[model samples]
Target: MKQTRISVLAVFLVLAMATAALAATEVRMVGDALVYGSFFSNRNFTGWNAPAWTSATPTWSKAGKKTEEAFEIWERFRLRTDFVANEAVKFRLEMKVEDTWGHGTFTAANPEVAIMIYGAYLQFKLPCTDVDVTAGLQNVALPQSKMFYGSPVFGDRMAALVVKAPLIDKTLSVMAGYGRLIDTNRTYDTTTTQVADELDAYFLALPITLDGFKATPWGAVAVAGKDANLFTLKSSQQNSSFYADNLTSAGTYATPKLWKNDQNAFWWAGGAFEVSALDPVKFYADVIYGAGAESDRKKSHRSGWFMDAGVEYTGWDVLTPKAYGWWSTGEDGSTANGSERMPMIRPNWGPGNSFLFDDSQELVKNSNMGMSPVGSWGLGVTLDDVSFVQKLTHRLTFLFVNGTNSARAIRTLNTLMGSNPYFQMGRDLTINEHVYGVNFDNKYMIYENLSAVVETGWAHGEFQQSVWGHSLVNQSRNGDTWKVSFGLSYKF
Candidate 1:
């Protein structure tokens, strides 16, 4: 039924485009041609003998070898056309289709789809300086980080109306707009009956120039509608024993308390600055803060911030050496109790099983991934070889996460009411973990429009908990993973 609905929507969109094309006076089309392909090999080690230094046992891993190999292809096509061009108003239409095919751990057969208004709106350019007014489904502007407010998860698509003007002696431009959060390609289950309405207002100030330094300050507030239902909350009452069918039986009853109020709102603000301090050194830094609870049932308010500061130096005079370091923190604010503060999901473990579902520190069995109070700091040194063969880039990065073992959210879930074995299946399995890895990528242009690439990586870490519990005995293990891949691609 869901698939049928999606197909009907697609057909309706096509017909609408056709009708618009026939009625337009002036038309222009633009697009891009792209073909991308890659191959990969993956391997994971989990079980009693897994890494010992990271804390916890491997409930998801058994003493064995698990591997997967596959290839993938990516293609995208876009079309844009202008319908009306006049002195006071101009209108345009845009459409795009993207498809993918592949195998392996990173591969999926289901092609992702996105359909949007694109540029199907009107723009009124005024005579004063460079000012414009835009209405209808238009582009929403935010800060430097694409992850905030925008569709960073899949594709960028939000509904909004924007106004543009010049400021600061014409040295700065400002954009203010109102937008709403719409369901993306991935929608929740309709049976859930929970809907969320998010309305946001954003403002951006971009300085034209400041002594050769560029800076921008952006801010936004998202007001959730009163009817928004964040998450389902339930409580259970357990009875030790009851007489049933001539036998003693234990019964558990769960009750639901429906919460229908919109006391939750989120505020986000940040700025970024870039400057060239010396002949060989360039500095950049960005800071962002977000606060407010996503739901009221938990009576929990989430607040976190992130900072990215780095300096890059280029040695163009010699080997063209490059070195830089980055630091990032803060949560994504998707979980009720701030589950983003953990690294259990999609950890960079070199080509091995991430054991994402086997986290012992997570209270919830299945949860979204995000930054745990833990922050990652890493430094990399890269050397570019442009003299011969294709451009060769070699990079080495070292990262460390703080507060890895401090995830009380997962710990509390496991110990709920104490001695609940079902809830403890994979809880508190591992403690703080330290990961180190090396990645190498080589790209060579086989022809004018074709290229060949080779990449490989290796990582090793220790687990901090026992895989199996034995009387008076606790044990841990160490593990390592590696992967290699080669592929060819064509671009136009």
Candidate 2:
């Protein structure tokens, strides 16, 4: 027994020495915590995700199974730690925890433990060179205007190896990387010896900066296997991968079928530019074109163009006003020629702090109500940082959008796929449909690292019966959408 105790002590001593050595390296941490409560009415505005109309429920419900107003409180926390050995090398690790207040089996006494790894990567410069390399799981976003936050085609986190090299001192640089989005063979069934269904993407960008202007031209291509997992899943308005489903040329949603080709290719090219030569007057813009999956059936192919621009005036002391506009090619009358909507891996684009689109939000689980800027166009005006009180600020915005999809095309899809939750009447609008909204957001600082936030919005949808049919129109007529959220955020 004494010998065993001695061995255990030796193990502990070794571990302590290792931990002390690691502490010698510089370590830093940054994180944020958020808690929020939300109350929303008529979130389903029209057809998508709403419960069926019946005597039991008069108003629109947020989900098919629920017949009540959507209300919930959620919380989340994120922490990122960096271990730096020198100016040229560092390792990053990020983790997160999030959940609804009381919906799950989690309780005060028996809490569920769920900690997710958000990022883990190593960043280092090459020896005797100016080149920088980042390898491992990390955030990836194609080049796009800063005003839009990130690329509309693809923006998310994935495992990748990226390299950046300087070419002309401070004038130009290049970035390139490769990412694997899906590997079904390993993800689902590793024992089977069948062909691997994989999806991989490659990206390249050239960033140029001058005295008063900056621009980035980027391109990306992806290869997908015939049995990629993205095609097998049920289509949903919440998931962008539904765009990969084989849509019939006649605008009908069909069951997943085998494709003629063993492999498919998707590509995108775009450029983003910012002009600040006028100082207080600045301009930002991005243009992108994408196409995907050329198979024997035209239904499997999709292609389109998207562009957005914004102008901001920062000369005012109390506020900065901005105007933004966007446009994209929409679906035509026929599905056989393929959809005119741009294909996206994952989109994280939005202008201003509009609640109608999936813009990043300060509160947890309070946004992304199935509105995306894929086949639509809109305009918005924002008064940002309007402050009259100390430690407090407010923002006001007005935004409107009009659908570009042909009315006939929408009618055809609804007639055949009306029961499919993926085809929402108001959320997926026709050329004759439109929506408008206004938002009032406020923030008050309690401390340097803590703040209280409140956001409220109202939206109205106009869906023509001639295009959406009587049933859909009736469901959509419940009322305008309204939402209010209050939250507290702490950063360190």
Candidate 3:
């Protein structure tokens, strides 16, 4: 009887060990680094010393001193680690560090550099089914074509849960997600006992793919409490005001304020399509409509439409030529009727390497000279991947932008605010204003995973004094602006 009991215990232990071995986890890591220095002038299109020209009343540019030389170096690094338990389950974590060259170092007598958690998520396949689910913080974007980089409504990192299921193998699928945009500590609100200052969004997408064509139709809805944190929608560092003036009717354009209601509703619908049936000649396009509604405050509401299209020819062995254009509804003369500009949460849309918009810049940081095309229309052309020698390539681009917003709207806002509303002069233009830009960028592969880059761009602005007023226009030196950046990138 004693031997029989011992044999049974040994068998149990053996089975446990076998199960553990079968479930062994695999770990993988990937990362990238970038270091760059940028030399720029007239970054604001108003000279380098424009900051010293501020006053209670707008003054003339000649009364202030201006400079044209400025330089800075920036560095960024990111690492992602993935742990796979099997073909069915996985977990990923990403960390990032980005800042000026010498600011955040303990040895430099400053605060120690901070490491940020860029993403952390778990992904798994449902039991007895093909459905896939991902939960936690991750990068999210609405349905959009690659030509414009991402959606014009919301494209960034957020805490969310996403699920995807294939309806017809690899040809058709459906995706759904929920993202939390803001949370002002509802559980810890000391005043009013219960607070409703949170924002949440839900989305759905349908994707269809054929032999040489693909399309995705998507829609989203968000609920925002009246006191939701608006600052959460802005980038860590911005070239100019993000939604300040674009949220037109909230108050005045010069000093806009948010109007409140118990709860606000925002909705968006869009579609992205790509066609490659024509081989070397390919086409891509996206159309979107978005709106915000408030029950009590009519001036707090906004709605509009936006669309963009692009064509690319990849027949040549050394170069690919592309053309892109975009249009969107803009504000009119009335303030009580609310803004006509398309409502956006955090837009990340652009085309090519043009400096006028936040396109594909190897630097990615401190180089976004142009704001999102909220109330604007543009046309651009690019000659991409022009290689004349081994491991060396160049890209040249030219772009033109014109405002779609009415000048009368700005004029009225300035009068109501009793201040200069042209603070974002070159960034936010009127229908009577325009700007053109050119870019010449170069890249040389140092190794299979390393490259050297050089980017240069220039922009010229055309503004009308009749719309912006002499005081604001004279205070701004709206001459040409330019920049030259050199950088190195390494990846594995």
Candidate 4:
């Protein structure tokens, strides 16, 4: 009886091992974090000139001329797991966390902690077919030589259903995806959070190879619900100044601009090509055009046409050169039906390490994730991947920018910790301000997964905004602004 029991136990062990091997689970984790600080000269402080070139009230601030600087840090972490449940079924789940230091009440009794689901989806092959289907939250990036329409433009994840199938075997591929930008929700705090306020988008792409070159033509369309845009919607990051008008949210010091109840349609079609058919003398280009309209929702006639083109030549690793130009129709300040300036954001390819220094953020538009290149157009040239020493590489870029729609310049400037409104707007501004800038970027690889970088940027120009500080003719122009930053980052 004892020998029989031992044989049974061995059989059970063998079965357990076989099941484990068949499961074929794989897990991986990769993350990166950055800690950096910058010193700003003439960044937060201008020579005033608020009341124009005069003696008293000449500068905007009471302290006359000023300068400010500070340091900041941020991090990003990701985890991914994949497993084969069966012969023809596979699944993957990815999670991510990204935030700058001091996001919320860190010392509070219940600190706010947020972790986003970056990618959580299921994948499987169709029975008796060479097609694949993926459903759930996913990562989607459009084709681009630059970052023209690549990656999640606004946020991290796309809750979508996607399908991919080969049309001509390995020569041509087609893909389609549909997703919801904002889910229809009924919030506990607001009764007006209706289903009709949700936003949805769709994407279609065809990537094909001809000889040694590849081409990708893609199209996308997004629909915004009534009063569902960033300006109209009130969230932690944006407000319509409705409360500021009544001295509530951020008090009366906040800039006041009423949001229009809008239903907007945005669409774009573009193509990218990689001319690698010529080996070391390869060339690349990306061209795009997009039009947006809000119809009669706002009664202001909001519409715009935007375009961008770029070319690059990577003949050598140490001295690649690239250039690009963009144009977007501007607004005429006409109160006809709506705004005419483009409402969508352009991919901000900064003159430097965009994280450390960027004109689009410091000069025109800024967002929580970094900088936004929208409502503006310009040209730029860059020298990339200059490496003369081991483990060190350098890059430099020069740029010129002008507002596309309005005289879009910053009005109020304050210290890093100063209590002033971070961004204040002036109604009577021009799209005439132009900026010429240069950037220097140096990167040093310390280890296989670690790096250190230094970056500097300088911009010399100014915008004239005359509708602030209780004055109708108070025009201001800040002279020169520069930033220097150093950072350390680790990835695995």
Candidate 5:
């Protein structure tokens, strides 16, 4: 696999060099720098005693006090060279890096380096149409948030071909590609060396505009060979009572075997409509259905759907605040019907690590879990002004998520928590969960090209059980977790 990847990269490099030599053009370089830092405080650091309780005993001291802090520096540089010919062809190369520096439990496990072909492709102009082809790492094109069937967190380094055609005064577009999905191999203490097989994906979309309204319909599909080791957990219950003893007795616990039908497939179709039917009031709505199944064998089929609708009242002339909300639900083959999916979470050392949830296994299970729906809705407000300092934006959102069945939720939570060795002695945390939160984000221009942002968030969750799967001494109905965060960011 290593040799194959090297050869493929070498071939692309040779092709790019040959193309560059054939066309003489000027090369331009672009770069950007960002510095981010955050701090967090939780009422229940280890999900033990809640509210405000004093540490009269040292045992309580070891259980309740928790705080986190972190810092990240990210930089990206790219080179673009445009050819000075009739059939202009452009070449681009980009590199990015994220450096994690600070003191925190979570920040210690962050990836030290992530190097890949950001975006590399070729474009040619024709008399009646334009054609663009990409043959390296790239991102997928989908509607809305790409939550249903899009790659938002990672990029695919593959060969892609895209074509655009104009007909009946309307434009049509199509694209298809095959590439290896990049999977990061990092742990709290060490990194692994492995690469999975290649995956294939394709997409089609059409856009039209009439009378200040635009509509787009898109469809996409993706397929990959069974690479369960790429995404599966090494242990069935990481934090379970079965973990430590198994490791001590047998050297390790038995991990679940990836099914033969592990080869995965997904399809999605949806449309987005934005209308100016109302003078100052614009409406937007979209819906999508996606499914993933075992391509190699036949047993269980998984599917999910997403729907979003909202209205924007821009007629508020000076202070135009738009309110919008969206909902997404999916089932990975990990759970059976009427089972709840549990999220596998690991405690981080710092605020930076604490913010990100380790839902990879749960997400995968959601794709295969019989049929479960997870939904969340939020409302936001934005202020758009022409003034120097007033050109700022602010939004407040309320999000709610819950599983349909208590049984399914329990199973999922069990699987997620069970996969971790730390929580092996106990069962997965199960509770009727409800969350309420508020967010504040601001952008201030300190200089001509330099800007700064100060963002903060406060969220609280009420759960029936403790995160450690321990039953409360008193069967009180009210047990909740509180989270607070503040951050500063600078861009240049």
Candidate 6:
């Protein structure tokens, strides 16, 4: 049962690291490493094959496929380590190295390379009361407001059993965790491959901070023991060659899984703040309210919600000025369970909060979006600590998008080749097309821990309807997409 529930906490953290190597309060060890290299370029291509809006010729390709180009080259690396044994024990281990920008060597004929375990936590401090107990495979964030737990799009490690207490002053803190998003190892399919575990959660949160501004009231849940009880949500790292799944009739292929029924057992509750009466002109407003999921019509009830408000003007630390708006609540995905859609349990935004659309855009830089997503406003600034360069920092954004055909939130391509093939999977071949973008990013700290990033954007898709009238019968079109990115961030 999950390795006997973490093997007695890994044998009590190796017996407290052998009593901290013979007590002396010295046994300390620290290390850190992170490297990020990226490059992504794109140009004119309507969400993968543009041109379509016909039935009487009002123009465009209507499925003729035109104007396309793309590129990608990314590299990421991480190697962290910490193992103190003093002032209240500690231990962490992160590793994800084994990279080679474009591969040329470093081939020990398969001396093994993939050794991932994002983190191996174990922090301590709980003998009489100051409570603080963390256990293995960690990295779970949620003070909400990334549109329901985000960061690298919920790609932030999770394998919990954590607790930290201090509620009622001492800065008011509280956290409770739990995990095991899914489990299935029927030893190789011991009969129809059943035997599922699921688990998944975040029992509660409370990081209050009255006047200092920093509120975090949270709650999350998910359960589904046994596969048939259903609860997929997949996409938790299963590259499968960057999204696969298209071979049924017994061939079976699909797996980025964003939804799987068995209904009711998903929850969300939120409150993330940082307003402090608008200090240097900064304000934030986060809102959330969710209710289960597991409906494909037939008696619907997978409720939904999401919101993010914003403002920033940082009293000119180097030119700051911003504005924001966000919303997530749309569905008509017409089954495959998208009706329960709530950003599909969020995470994955950025790229101007997803006008970079897909998972449904909501940008603060980037995120992978699109399940009933919305982004109406976002004006930006912050030119940098410039004057000569004080660890440079530049940002500029402007995006406005209207949701819907975030590619039919997929649902098997909007229920079988969207843009309306049998039904109006959003009528008009799929809708969505009011994008307007512009962004310029910059980050430079070339020294002291090394950092350097560059981002670029240019957009124009306008097409919420217009092919003469009702647009022939939608199939999603409207083009003009541009991008450029470059990065190098290192820390040690």
Best by TM-score: 2
The per-prediction CA RMSD against the true structure, in angstroms, equals: 11.7, 6.4, 9.5, 11.2, 11.3, 23.3
Which regions of candidate 3 fall more than 4 Å away from where they truly are?
A: 1-24, 48-69, 106-111, 231-239, 243-257, 418-423, 466-472, 475-478
User: Candidate 4 vs. truth: CA RMSD?
Assistant: 11.2
Tens-place lDDT digits, model 2, residues 1-492: 454455456546634644664866777779999889888777767423442322111112223444444787878888887878899999897877777787432345555555667798999999999999999899888998887776777777889999999999999999999998777676565456555477788999999999889999999998877555654432232342243432222232443433456677889999999999998999999999988766546766778899999999999989999999999988898765667877777676777777776665566375545565767899999999999999999999898999888877666655655534334555566778888888889999999999999988888898878765676577668778888999999999
List candidate 4 stretches off by more than 4 Å: 1-24, 38-69, 84-89, 97-114, 128-130, 147-156, 184-195, 227-229, 232-264, 277-279, 293-300, 345-372, 406-429, 467-479
Better of 4 and 5 by lDDT: 4
Provide the TM-score for each candidate, comma-separated. 0.59, 0.87, 0.86, 0.69, 0.62, 0.28
On the 0 to 100 scale, the lDDT of residue 281 in model 2 is 96
Choose 1 or 6, whichever is better by TM-score: 1
Count: clashes, candidate 6: 33
Across 1-492, the per-residue lDDT of candidate 3 in tens digits comes to 354355456445634644564557777779999999987777656653322213212222331245644787878888787778889998887877787766663225544546677898999999989999999999888889888887778777789999999999889999999998778675676586576667788999999999889999999998766555543334322434433233324332223345555567888999999999998999999999888764546666788899999999999989999999999987787766777888777667788878777656787776756555778899999999999899999999998999988887766765554333233456667888888889899999999999999999898887767665564466454557778999999998
Among all windows of 10 consecutive residues in model 5, the one with the lowest summed lDDT is 344-353
TM-score of 3: 0.86
Backbone collisions counted per model: 32, 2, 0, 11, 40, 33
For 196-255, candidate 4 gives per-residue lDDT tens digits of 456677888899988878888988887765433332222211121111111111111222
Off by over 4 Å in 2: 1-21, 46-65, 187-193, 231-258, 466-472
lDDT of candidate 4 at residue 37, scale 0 to 100: 56
Residue 458, candidate 4: Cα error in Å is: 2.6
lDDT for 485 (candidate 6): 57
Residue runs of model 6 more than 4 Å from their true location after superposition: 1-81, 85-89, 92-137, 140-153, 157-159, 162-177, 180-263, 266-292, 295-299, 302-330, 333-343, 349-430, 436-445, 452-492
State the lDDT of candidate 1 residue by residue for 69-120, as single tens digits: 3344544455666655565566666665544444221245543345434556
Report the error of model 4 at residue 135, Å.
2.3
The alpha-carbon lDDT assigned to residue 279 of candidate 3 equals: 86
